[model samples]
Target: MCNYGGGLGKSLKPFVEYNEPGKIMIIETPQSKSAQLSACWGPIESARAKVRGAEGVIVSGNVRQVDQFQDAGLPVLSRGIAALGPREYMRLGSVNETLAIGGLKVDPDDILLADDDGVVVVRQQELSQVIESCEYGVKHDEVVLQAIAEGSTMKEAWRKAYDLLGPPVEYARPFRR
Candidate 1:
C-alpha cells in the first residue's frame, strides 16, 4: 500500500548532486501519534528524496518500497516498511514540513551527514562548523585506527588520540539561488 511512486519512486538527484563527494544523511522529524510511521516516513517530505535522483532515502519513521526502492539500487536507510500506504493513515500533506525523526528535530534545509557508521543532523546554521569539527575528528580517528592496525597497543592509541584536532571552524550552508 505504501508508495515509492510519486517523486519518491524515481531516482533522487538534488541530494546526490548537492551533496557531491560527501554522503547525504536524512534525519526524519518524528511524529507524535504514530511514531512508527515517522520511523519510516518521518512527518515531512523533505527527508524523502525527490524520487527522481537522490543520494539516498533515510526513513526516520517507517519506509516501504523494499522491492521498488531496492531494485533500483536506491540508497535507502529505513527502520522498516509496512504494506500500508500513506493514504491509509494520512493524505494531502505537503512536502517541506518540519519533521522529527530518530529523536532529533530536523528542519527543512538542514545539513545531513551520513556514512556506513550512521547519520547526523547538522542544524542549518551549524552545518559548516560541524563539518570542520567532524573533518578533524575523522582525520584523527583515521590515524588512531591506523596505529591500532599497525600493532600499536589500544592504550597507546587511545593516549595518542588526544589533541588530534585541527582548527575549529564553522559550517555554513552555501547561499543558494
Candidate 2:
C-alpha cells in the first residue's frame, strides 16, 4: 500500500492491482526521490483482515497511514515518508505493471519476507526455502532466548542459536527503490 491520504504531487501512479497477502508484488514506476508513497492500504484494515497473520509487510515502495499501524505496532518496512499521499500522487498507474520496488523486481505471487531487520522479496520457486529458513532461524533464536533467560552468556546463547539453526541464509538481493 503506497500513499497515505496526504495528497501532494506525483499524480498518475499505479492503480490497486492485487490484494493477496504473503506474496511479493513489485512496482516498476521508476525510482522516485523517495519510494515513500504512504499507506492507502489502511493499516488497521489490514490488521483486521489478518493478512499474512504472522508475516510482516515489506513495501519496496512507500507506505502511508502511519498512525494506524504505528499504534498497533504492526511491522511495516518501506523506503521513506510520503507527505504527498495517494489521492494526490497516485492515479492507478498500471495494475500488475511489473513495477520496480526499491530496485527489486516484483512479480505477482513472489514471496515477501519482512521482519525486525527489514524487508526482502523471494522468487516464487524460492519462497518455500526462504520460509523454512526463517522458521528455522526463529526456532534457533527461541532456544537462545531461553538459554539467556537461564543465565547463559550472550556468546553461549548465540552458540545455542547457531547450533539449532545450523547457519543463516544471507539475503543477496540489493534494496534500492
- In model 1, which range of ten residues has the least summed lDDT? 1-10
State candidate 1's TM-score. 0.58
Per-candidate local distance difference test:
0.51, 0.53
Stretches > 4 Å off in candidate 1:
1-51, 163-177
Model 2: number of backbone collisions = 24
lDDT of 1 at 51: 39
Query: Highest lDDT among the candidates is held by which one?
Result: 2
Error of 2 at 100 (Å): 1.6
* TM-score of each model, paired residue for residue: 0.58, 0.54
Clashes of each: 31, 24
What's the TM for model 2?
A: 0.54
